[model samples]
Target: MTASAVKQGQTTTGHALPILSLAVGTFGIGTGEFAMMGLLPDVARSMDASIPQCGNIVSAYAMGVVVGAPIISLASARMSRKQALILLTLWFAVTNILGTLAHSVGALEFWRFLAGLPHGTLFGGSALTAASLVAEGRRGKAVGHVFAGLTFANVVGAPLASLMGEYLSWRVAYLLVGAIALIAAFMIWRFIPRDDPRPGHSLLGELRAFGRKQIWYVLGVVMLGTGGMFCVYTYVSAALLHVTHVPLWSIPLFQGLWGVGMVVGAYVGASAIDRNPLGATIGAFIWNVVTLSLFAFALPHLWSVTIIIFLLGGTIALGPAMQMRLMAVAGDAQTMAASMNHAAFNLANALGAWVGAFVLASGFGYAATGWAGGGIAIMGLLLFLLSVRGEPRLERSTDSSVRFH
Candidate 1:
């Protein structure tokens, strides 16, 4: 069935199952992606590498996301979204198991990179599928529902994986993630509705979506705005240990609190995005500036820092609005643009970590990361302004039905 046929066939209430199934897949991806942050110490010890060297593993996974999203999205453009989701989840499960079997840091990094290959594609596909299930005006909420899994991972999956890595083995964490991925694959196969392949959708048609100036601007907004959060988060464990003087057991607690904030933010952001996507994006950026900057000052007091961490996690509320913005601006190439949103996020991951590592290496201290993050958030706000300024011209040139708001 064509997209219109599928859309017309479903009632709003019927969307629940498919969206939940997609969220399950996203939960697994989120666990596998962020679990490494908490497991970095164990991984470093196991591989006889320094903490910073283990950071390379995070960068490697992010690099794969950046490289894989567009390739997988375009390559699978003509396939049914259902088929693409299944294949992607299967790839995710297998690669994570491979990660568990790696005997050396090099091998493990390679597997992590391979495991990350499906991350963006799965999210992009899930977002598109979820959006299709709902009414047009409800697309932002649909997308947010899918991303809630990622946010919830911080609450449930990442912390559990971290605890397991701490008490058992880091390898056990990967094993658990692999299990979750397998379960997600099964749920996706059982629950997600079949989407017919886009008629006449070709690589060239997808590629041409990049020709739009607004797409580039939105991508820039993602790359810059989202990097600040990753900058602070990538090194959060180190900050908790060294700066806050927290015990190992307490780290996951803070991480879980952050996750709670994310859950709240996702729901809140969904409503905000549905109202005014551009305004929500700008507001999220501004929120990032306040929280990240405050984090620097809050570091000296554990209680204060804890609150800041929770607030910082809420910055992710920006994601659904941004995703919706890309959908509106992408025109014909929805798959590539949607997938590229996560690619841009992981690129922020790499960029933030690299920049944070540099600042730490320079002896500015762990708290300096918040300062750097705050600066990056400011840059994101400026990009949002630039995009806003150009909106009128972009609106005239594109389809009138696809409103950025």
Candidate 2:
């Protein structure tokens, strides 16, 4: 067959299956990734380590995201997106399996880092595929649908997996993740259309994304904005235990509720961005800041805290809007930008957790994290406003290519 025929075949196949496959793969990744947080205390006890020492696992994962995203996006520039995703997920599956057998904190941390290596690249590449499958006006929504899988993980996977770890063994959670990843890999291999690798694409060209100032602005906003959620989520169990005083059996309820919030947030945010990108972005930041503040006050009263947690999850709507913003400004470096979105979130994960830890370490207690989360959200809002003020380095053409009513 002619090379063009292969390319055409790949594109057609991608249209039919790659998007759903990507979503499924992301679901596995999301489950594997966040499940660790809920299982942290268990793993720490098993390894005879301190809780903070165990936090190194989370740090290791975030470090992998930070270092691996750009490198993978650039290094795989010559490969088909389909091939890249398959390889990434395979690696993800292997590392997760290895993580199940870790006997020491150091070993666990190393494997966690390895597990994280493909996260950003997978999300970015999968998103690119998802976007290509849709009409121009609907690209954000398409991408959002894929992300909804990850959000669903937060509601369903994380809570259930965490409960499993809490009652059973943390190793079981890792094993389950591995099984899910293997399934995702199979789905990708079977469903994702095989695209011919872009011949002219080069690592150097993708790395040029760093030259754009707008990219940095978007990254900054993403780091601060999304970090707000992490600041609270990372400590939610503790809050439920310490402040809300929920029974042990009901702890999963909070995690599940948080997931429910995420689902609603993703849907609302996805639809809102389809209508008004800018408004959605700014509104998400505001909602996070306000709701998080309320969350702090409500922690002492369980009913109010439940309401706040729901709202806390809802603020996740900012995720898709911010991702679409980066796509708009990223020019030809779409892969790098897409991958960097997860990197940004991982960074937020680290940042929010560290800040929350600092507050708790200082004896302020778990509820202090809400204030920190709110502060981070407010910072994100400020950054978004700055972007709106014509910061030359961060400006993208306001071309209305994808008109929304």
TM-score of each: 0.95, 0.93
Each model's C-alpha lDDT?
0.85, 0.81
Pairs that clash in candidate 1: none
lDDT of 1 by residue, 1-405 (tens): 234644566655777877888999999999999999999889998998888778889988998998899899888998888988999999999999888888778998899999988888899888878877766667778889999999999999899988998999889988989898899888888888666675578678678768988788888888889889988998888898998999989988988999999998889988788776656777788898999999899987998999999998899988887888888878778888888999998988888888898889899998999999999989988987887794653322223365221
lDDT (0-100) at residue 25 of candidate 1?
91
Give the number of the best model, judged by TM-score: 1
> Candidate 2 — number of clashing residue pairs?
2
lDDT of 2 at 323: 80
Model 2, span 1-405: residue lDDT tens:
122333354443345556677778888888887887888888988999988889889999999998899988888878888788889999999999888888999999999998998999998887777766655556677778888879888878888888888889989888888888888889888876567777787567678889998788889999999898888888888788877898877767787788788889988888878777777777888899999878789998988998888888887798888888877777778789888988998999999998888888899888888898999989999988887675442223224442210
Evaluate model 1: give its lDDT: 0.85
Winning model by lDDT: 1
- Clashes per candidate, residues 3 or more apart or on different chains: 0, 2
